[model samples]
Target: MPSSVEPARPAGHHTPGPPGPAPATPPSGDGSRVIPFGRRTTRTGRGRRTPQPPQPERVVAPDSPQQRLALDVEAWFLAHQATLTDEAAAHVYRTTLDFLQLMLTSSHAEERLSPDEYQHLTGMMQVLRDAPDTL
Candidate 1:
């Protein structure tokens, strides 16, 4: 006959039972239904729908007076390339060439100068033409 005490099972053996239903979630404090984890909640207030600030206008006006003067100085250096002194002229020539090349490369087509820009360039040319040998 079998003994009253049950024998111990081997290391990995076990009996299976019926699966239980999933646990119910707790109610929210405000009395609204609670969502599951990893979900975003909808915003409640109208303040959440605030509009963005307007962007600034972009104007592409021509270059300013100082820029025109710089160009004029550059042109004077170019026209007097032969007269530039050995000490100063080489450096000035290289720098002016670089500036002129950059201006030309950036523009899609050659831009016509304003009357003021032209006057500024011509005035600079006159000064270089009349300046003493010391310059």
Candidate 2:
């Protein structure tokens, strides 16, 4: 007895065409297809790209001997102030007051002191009275 089986269709027949490579696609107006390697593309709306504003340059002053000396004196005074005990600080305070009063009296006698200087001297005297004497 002969078998009654139909012949199987070939794979190429089902797909059609000689499979001779895919057809080339035309480029889209949006430029989405071609990308440069290692570079990214940004989508900017129809406006023109504006250049960024320049940054302001910083100005620095050169250090001078007088300024350095002033800083050194300030630092030394701060260190000395830090090391003082309450009793010693009180004594220093009294001494400073006496010295300032002497200077103010001399300035008054010489008529060389400005009103502002006299007022500042008085303010310093008041501050010394209120300040804690020792560290």
Best by lDDT: 2
RMSD of each: 21.3, 20.0
- TM-score of each model, in listed order: 0.20, 0.34
Stretches > 4 Å off in candidate 2: 1-78, 81-85, 133-135
52-117: candidate 2 lDDT, tens digit per residue: 898864332345443444344445557876422355755675687788888887896788888888
Range of the 10 consecutive residues with the lowest summed lDDT in candidate 1: 126-135
Task: Give the per-residue lDDT digits (tens) of candidate 1, residues 14-106.
Answer: 433225653476444854333335645586676776787987644323464444544565567668664344546646655665566455444
TM-score for candidate 1, residues paired by index: 0.20
Distance from true location, Cα of 64 in model 2, Å: 34
Tell me the lDDT of model 2 at 80: 74
